[model samples]
Target: MKKLQRIFIYTFLSLAAIVSIFPFLWMLVSITNKSVDVTQGRLLPGTHLIENMKTLFATVDIVPALINSAIIAIITTILTLLLASLAGYGFEIHRSRGKDIVFTILLLSMMIPFAAIMVPLYRMFGSISDTAPFIGIDSLGAVILPTATTAFFIFFFRQNTKMFPKDLVEAGRIDGLSEIGVFFRIYMPTMKTTYAAAAIISFMNSWNNYLWPLVILQSPEKRTIPLLISNLGSSYSPDYGVIMSAIVIATLPTALVFFLMQKHFVAGMMGSVKG
Candidate 1:
């Protein structure tokens, strides 16, 4: 019976691994195949990889899109880390009824689907130049602003802050450090793992964010990778090779971020457990 159970578990794990990895393998295979070959599900690499890249670049100005994505992702990640971390620290450390209610409200706000608020959010950013009441209408700022404060990130930071040693806070106070100084110098440094995990997550989300950006970034010149990839997919005569190549390119940064931050992510969660 135990042998059977072991076999079953191993089979399940193998299946799961295959299921997870097959798409990426298919994508890689497709990247090196011609458009028609890819569409026909050829599992072998072709010599069209270079041609496909050339076709993609010729079809869309991918350099600009890549730049736009990088700018939005980097700025959004930084803002999210700073604001969310501060808010999280405050919620955990300050202990006030009003703030608790506000935090709970923010938590509840997450349940409201972005689709439901899409109209208002879009309008809030405004449509044309000088007509919008709020800032960031029809610009990269618009792309970065909506996602600047990720709720889950804020929640993650708050939960991590709960593990923060109050003794450290008091110690800082005794050493003549202001609250802001303690947060910047002490709490921030000590929570490196959590910050790393959050940074990777936030960057990936901002990088891959599609729906809002799709709706907001109307100009072809302002397109991001996701938008560019979508554009490639929707071409009148779609080039599967080119699309797959774009997918690979689009996926690399997120993959790199996860790889670089995986250790820190583990450390952060472990620290959270200890806290």
Candidate 2:
């Protein structure tokens, strides 16, 4: 009976894993096949991989879109780590009246759906387009600004900060370090795993962000990877192979980022829970 139960568990886990991974497997296979072959549900790999890639690169503005995505994701990740860590450190370290109340409000704000404020955010950016073209609508700054830091990130950092040793801050202060110096030299280094986790999440969010960027950016050159992929499917006669190729390429960066920092991400999340 125990052997039968063990077999059942393993079989169930195997099925679940296959279900989760099938779409990605299909996508990779589709990229190597022609549009007709892909549409016909070919499960086997084909010889059209090079042809599809050549067409995708030769015809699409994938390179520019990739560059735009990289710029926004990188900048947003950096700003999020900086601002969220600072806020988290302060909330955890500084004792002040109504601090919990303020933090509560911030967390509640996350419950408000982005769709609810999309119009207002668009109008706000539109209102400033003429005065600040650099950060206005249709610009990369617009894409990065709204998502530079989120309530979830703040909450995440704050939770993780709870586990941090307060003695270090005191030690740094005793050593005559300023608040800024202590944060930069002591806090940042000690929280490397948390930062790594935050970075992975932030970068992935910014890279895959479509709605705000779609609404804000109108120019072709300003388009990011998601927007570019949307365009690939917009045509009346969409090429499945090319679309899959683009998707595979678009997926590579986030995949690479996650795998590279996977260890740190798990550790940081565990730290957050322990805190």
Q: For model 2, what is the C-alpha lDDT against the true structure? A: 0.91
State the lDDT at 196 in candidate 1.
85
lDDT of 1 by residue, 136-169 (tens): 5558987788789866777889888887899999
Model 2, position 87: C-alpha lDDT score = 93
Query: What RMSD does model 1 have?
Result: 2.6
The per-prediction tally of clashing pairs is 0, 0
The per-residue C-alpha lDDT of model 2 at residue 228 equals: 95
State the C-alpha lDDT per candidate. Answer: 0.84, 0.91
Candidate 2, residues 158-247, lDDT tens digits: the string is 998888899999999999999999999999999987898888878888999999999999999999999999888888999999999999
TM-score each candidate.
0.90, 0.94
Which stretches in model 2 have alpha-carbon errors above 4 Å?
Answer: 1-4, 267-274
Please list the residue runs of candidate 1 whose C-alpha ends up more than 4 Å from where it truly belongs after superposition.
Answer: 1-6, 131-134, 265-275
Whose TM-score is greatest here? 2
